[model samples]
Target: MNLFDRLLLFILSVVALVLGVAVVLVGAAVPIGWAQMELTRHPYNIVTMVVGGVTALIAIRFLFFRRRRDPKLDSVMVAGDHGPIRIAYDTIVQLANRRGSQLKGVASFETVVRQGQGGLVLTLHMRVLPDIDVAALAKEAQNAVKSYLEETTHVPVERVLVQVTELGDNNRSMRVWSGTGA
Candidate 1:
């Protein structure tokens, strides 16, 4: 949460606690030296005090509570012959890039790997050369990356998603402008 939100919550909790304690004291027939009233004489005063005290306690507890976050999983563990082996995500990305760069019509690419239940999921964001079939390029990239990662890392690939981001002019021939209206 943001600082402003935290500050607001803290202020509200303090207010709730003060009001709750005053209500409870008054319900128990104890005089609240500041405010003089007959709230304790009511038949439902006990119920009101109970609700108020619970609300205040809850607010107090929440004021000190913090949410827990899970640590990031950056490496995958594989059982080796001697012991367990850890494969870093950077290594997988490098392997994926190697495989993708080898494909024709692929100008540049970026790969992301996510650990899944069955296996690893690879997503490739690519910039391909102009005048090429995007569908074919995507299919080729998916197959190449999936097979390459599986063979090299010995990890099963559940899915390979290919996103053709842009058309690159890296393979185009250079042209010179004549400045005139030629």
Candidate 2:
């Protein structure tokens, strides 16, 4: 997917292949050890070594040179030491922001989170482009929020309440964020 993921996969492939070859070699060595034989007697040893080197080289290329990359988000929603849910409120806010930003016509949005007026309610102050489908966007965001938070954090998100805060023209607001730049 992403650069990090591709590299990880490459490293794992190399390791697994090496381990597999090693096992075969060790298995062959046991019988030879009993019979007092040498590696030169086994013609397949050369082929095995060559294949192992080629496999390692290919893995290295995938790990270092491939261009297409995806974002590797390992951590999403882990719970807190002392909270109603293991997941912190900030975590929910982050999921809301990510979901809102992913929507097609969202301009920008700010999160104003508060303790649930009902039960574990999340509210988003989303600014959107004027021409967007408001209802469909809300539905999409809600679904994404629910799916991501549940899978990553292992927490049940009861409600994602969204409010259309404003229609953004996109000049000044785009340059600023609720907090410092990443």
Candidate 3:
């Protein structure tokens, strides 16, 4: 649950606990001054009952129906000769990035790794240098990333999807020469 929900639940729980204790004390006929004066009165008793009932219901709903966050998969397990080996997804993605970035045409890139039934699926989103062949670069990137991850992690790579998102020489300076330029 979120912070606000948790805080509201806590407040409701405290109120419910206090109300329960007061009810028990009143039922047991312990002569508390506030209980005798306030609780025994007409409007105060009704308002207290309504507020207590609503608080109890809200607390129950919060406890039972709170939103659950999906668990993030940090690592994948691979079978080995001795037993099993755990490889972190971050390591796999880093390897893919290393191989992809090493290619000549690649300027910069971001990668994502998804766990598939047979193995891992890698997706690369990249920016390439101007005048580079985007289609060739994308194909090369897919093969490079797939082979590198499979070899390094010893895990099957189901697919590698590459997208050439941008084409630019980010390090190059551009000069706009007007007709009256120096």
Q: Please say which candidate is ahead in TM-score: 2 or 3.
A: 3
Q: How high a TM-score does candidate 1 get?
A: 0.57
Rank list by TM-score:
3, 1, 2
Each prediction's total of clashing residue pairs, residues at least 3 apart in sequence or on different chains, is 0, 4, 0
Provide C-alpha RMSD values for all models, in order: 10.8, 15.4, 10.4
Worst 10 residues of 2 by lDDT: 69-78
Structure candidate 1, residue pairs in collision = none
140 Cα displacement, candidate 3 (Å): 0.3
Tell me, by lDDT, which candidate is best: 1
Candidate 3 per-residue lDDT, tens place, 72-139, comes to 46678888999988888888878888898888767787889888888888889898887667898899
Model 2 CA deviation exceeding 4 Å by range:
1-86, 113-119, 170-182
Give residue 79's lDDT in candidate 3 (0 to 100): 86
* Candidate 3 segments exceeding 4 Å error: 1-72, 170-182
TM-score, per-candidate, Cα-based:
0.57, 0.43, 0.59
Model 2 shows how many backbone clashes?
Answer: 4
lDDT (0-100) at residue 98 of candidate 2? 78
Q: Where's the lowest-lDDT run of ten residues in candidate 1? A: 171-180
For residues 89-118, what per-residue lDDT tens digits would candidate 1 score against the true structure?
889999999889878777788999998889
